[model samples]
Target: MDLPQLGTNLLNRVPPRLLSAAERYLKSVPLLRNRLEKETDSMLAGLEGDLKPYRGQLPTFATLPTQGLSHEQVLGEMSQMKEKEEHRWKDGLVSGAVYHGDSEHIDFLNRVYALNSQSNPLHADLWPSATKFEAEVVAMTAHMLGATEANAGRPPEQHICGALSSGGTESIMLAMKTYRDWARETKGITRPEMVAPSTAHTAFDKAAHYFGIKMVRVPVGPDYRADVKATRKALNRNTIVIIGSAPSFPHGTIDPIEELSELARKRRIGFHTDACLGGFVLPWARKLGYPVPEFDFRLPGVTSMSADTHKFGYAAKGTSVVLYRGTALRSHQYFTATEWPGGIYFSPTFSGSRPGALIAAAWASLVSTGEEGYLDATRRILETADAIKRGIRAIPGLHVLGEPLFVIAFGSDIVDIYKVMERMSARGWSLNGLHKPAAVHICVTQRHTQPGVAERFLEDLRAAVEHVRANPGEKGTMAPVYGMAGTVPFRGILSDLLKKYMDLLYKV
Candidate 1:
């Protein structure tokens, strides 16, 4: 076949309906499979250089080196990478990566981490401090999210309890798995389903796929909040849980957890509130008189919630807390295999071994940054966010989505937002690009709280918008990606590209 005809033939064979059959038929042909694999390997070869940037400059060890590298060499390389990555976040030129960038606070957390580096919670007998620190971290996070108010006169078992997970995704996945098990055991639900806002984190969908649960994603209303009626309609028999976010990742709009959780309560199903991005900041912002919604255990029907200590909580990057209304609900998340040759192999989370240093850093951060500290930090962050929101709103042709507090998403109808995003990225601002409705978001953090950071952001954003307006046909890297996805008829190509991207990420 000619090149054009061959391309058309391959494209025509890749339809969604024909995908499974194509895969089967193609796999049955060894030559076709070999050709495809070879092409993929060659394409991926071009990406391996970018993936392993430290190839010759530093030693790359997939396994333990026979001779340990000097500690100085390891620290030197880490310092070099930190220096390269820190300028944007440290100088307040980026979004959401480094929450609290004050050197003193980071040093303190690092000190705490160093103190507990050798401790492992899995070996509680050897390092009781790890368990104690983790327990306290959970307690502190729980109380911050309204556990104390919810369990004022309740029994110890009824009080809020939780486990510290690796990050927000783990916390959310653990909660979903818990609900799945709870529904199966208690309500005789074999095929469980969860009702979640379309704006809910993708982690819920990940959990549903991994745990054999059906995820019914209900769309958000015009204001970007979850549609309560749609959520109610989505729930049916075998519904295990309903999920809402304090402030969703896409539009930064808080869902009406009070109403949604109440609906779940009426149905006697579990309700989970994902507050990973906002849990630590919203309480203080509300106390500071910012308009915040009720999205915690303080609500009568919210059975569980997940909050990241890494984001706004100012701890290290590996820790988040998942709280349940009671110990019974959390027990569903544990694993125990008493008959194993390993002799009672058990773990509270997915991983067998846990990082104790992260737990210690989390605990230390909580204690060091008390209510007073959080209140002050929230004041700075909210004030900065307010300035940013106002600045973005003032710019012509651009609009901020929802009445958000900290995390702000804005887009333009008159210009391509992805092109604008590409401009911001070129100017050394790493912001998040959102699709489905095609918007870009800048998640405000402590980095943006620095002097003139918000002003610089506004200035850069205005310039970016102007550039995109002038050059309407500017095709940048992600601009074409988002544009193609939005305007294309076939999503199978996007799926394949995403799979390839994932493979690239894990190539090394």
Candidate 2:
């Protein structure tokens, strides 16, 4: 009998509980554990060269040197590494990593960072400038995402309020933490849960794991957006919040936020729109006449949002904004201990001492790149994305996954899509490989907006398709890895592999 038939037969012979316990026992067995570790080691060994290219060539400082290295020597080594790495993203050969790589913009942000290097928001009295910059950054981001409309008749307390977090993950985790605390304190709910579409960013899962909140992931619709009905059904008395992404990370399709948030509103539960990817682009896109939906504070049901200033906002990498409908809700995100003998202590977000230079850089990026700058950048990015999407669809076996603005995901019906992705990588293109439905995505940025970059991408992509189609039997580096990751039925094995891979990163 086939493996599937044998599994079915075994399942029929044994109760699910017993089968699960037996599987756990088998996984825990010394021999099985050793085999799993061997498999994980093999996979990671293949990735080690790429992950640790400078391991032997450069200094591996597991501990600091007794004497400080000269600034010139340290900078020389750093410059060499930067020179090696910058070409790919600098020339638009990659995706998403370096959003705005223009020399002038980078230099300007660097100068801003240098000027504010010593400043820390934790010492507000010492560095009042950091406080002003953070407040203005939040206000500007909130206004851009419909705070003006949402707070037209409301007081300062009722107006949209937020804190600057380290990045999208921090922003999202902060919001989830806020909801957990709010629900526990107000609703007296001990077992809190959050409902979100499966397509939502994995940060929500991280938050769920970290904060002891149960995450109920509803499946996306046929179009790959969040399924409103399924999400509504996932909610219960213990549900503290519902999350929807404005252009989710995988497929770049915006969820039906209006409907999902409305459900949360009627229930008096929190609704968080994760706009980390789309927050900076969508508002400008809407102004330029894209079919942008209402996913921000303009919607009465949206109680909170998380937007990354680093990505499309064209700032230094560390800043993100997490906004709440009102100060009352945001207060739950704060950490305070007035009774501490050290002193009265309080922090707005997770971090106590933050890189205020990055906050200053975020401020500079926003102020310098005003509405006109963002509008122009958004226009170029969207145009490039449209061309790329059309090009992918034009390929014989490939199809673009959903309606997307800047991030375009495409899959194949007749080709080994991962092999195609591997071919693209061979041709100097770095793309995101997605599972669930085997696909690859390229997030369009200003780098791709440069002259000939989009054309080169499309041409290389077409050539990659043809290459994969011609070389059907040829094994490729990442293709087998992606194939195994996608098709493996034992998810625990994959999780263990990932954990081991993370362990590899810490090795000197």
Candidate 3:
């Protein structure tokens, strides 16, 4: 029989769970395992060549060369790689990686980094400037998120405060760990749980796995916003925190933070507003008269928030801000050790010796792009996003998933959206393919706001949709993988495939 007939026979013969287990066992057999290994090796061999293009051209350094390479040689190699990689992002053919690609800003930040490359925030006395930058970054981010209003009459310890983390994942993990500890100590609850929307970032799940907290995910409503009533039902005495997103990463739909936080507030539990994607944009979007909701400390219920300075803030990578309603709650995130062989030791985030240059870069980005600059940038990004959304809606069989600002997700009723995404990839557009609803999205940034970028994107997208509609039988690359990953009954098999793929990343 053919592939379709076989698939139908398998589905008609047995339940999915048993079939999944049997397939898993069959794949574990020696002959099948060998075939799998051969296929994986062949695939990775192609990826290896692409990842290490200079392997044959450059001198090998399995062990560092007997003598050090000259600075000129190192710079030449790096410059070559940079030249090769910068064109796509610089010319606006990609998605959300490079937020601010202006050469002047990059050069300015590089100068700041060079001046402070030797500094380390772990040694406060050695780098007082780093401490100043860190404190100010936190303060400025807090003030932008309504700290001044939240702490109007509060004491310093009871006022909004936080620390700088490497990125959004670290910030979120830090908050989750803090709540787990706080709940255990203050409420004497051994079992800890946190409620969050289904659209919440995977970092929360990672936090739950790492910190031993139970994560309860409440599904979103028809509009793709969090279901506040469902979230209320998911809470219990053991619920230490509740979470909402200010424009989630997948669909970019802002949750009903006001209601969710109010629910948490009435229960006297922590409420974390994950604004990692929107923290820098929404504040300005609200100022621009966008329909933004209360997802900050201005609400009495919100106790914590995570924002990425790297994304829309136009800061360098390796910097994010996690703010708490009060310093007392943030104190639980601190790590201190008094019994070390050396002197006392303490750290606010995960890393022991953090790079001060990144802190300086973050500070410089914020200072250079003040309120006026951010507002202008947000305006451009939103306008570009609006154009893309409108264009997608106009295309036949395609519909915008939800009301989004900078990140717009679209799906199709008559064609496989993944196939369309594959066609878009072929046309030099790198978009995010989302599952569950099987859609795709492009996160508009400063790069996309450049002249003709939005029009080109829409034109290519329309052509791709028409092509997919004409060639319905053509199974393009990556579409089947996406389809299988999304619809497969054996989730464990997919998880294993991911693990193997990650392992390949480390292979030299």
The lDDT leader among the candidates is 2
Per-residue lDDT of candidate 3, residues 1-508 (tens digit): 7996477456646876787887789678999878866765555565566566777776656677778889999999889888888998998988898998999988998998898898899999999999999999999999999999999988888789999999999999999999999999999989999999889999999999999999999999988999989998999999999999998999999999999999999999999999999999999999999999888999999999999999988888879999998777888999999999998999999999999999999999999899999999999999999989989999999999989888899998799999999899889888899987889989899999999999999999999999999999998757876887666655665676667767766655
Taking all chains together, each candidate's TM-score versus the true structure is 0.90, 0.96, 0.94
Q: What do the candidate models score in CA lDDT, each in turn?
A: 0.89, 0.92, 0.90
lDDT of 1 by residue, 351-396 (tens): 8899999999998998999999999999998899899999999999
Ranking by lDDT: 2, 3, 1
The lowest-lDDT stretch of 10 consecutive residues in candidate 1 is 485-494
Backbone clash numbers for all candidates listed: 0, 0, 0
Error of 1 at 340 (Å): 1.4
* lDDT agreement of model 3 with the native: 0.90
lDDT string for model 2 (1-508, tens) is 6996476456557765776676688688999988878877987899899989998788878899999999998999999899989999999998798899999999999999999999999999999999999999999999999999999988989999999999999999999999999999999999999999989999999999999999999999889999888887888899999999999999999999999999999999999999999999999999999999999999999999999999999999989999999999999999999999999999999999988899999999999999999999999999999988888888899998889888899999899999999998988889999987899999999999999999999899889889888889978878888887776555566687788889999877
By lDDT, is 1 or 3 better?
A: 3
* Total clashes in model 3, counting residue pairs 3 or more apart in sequence or in different chains: 0
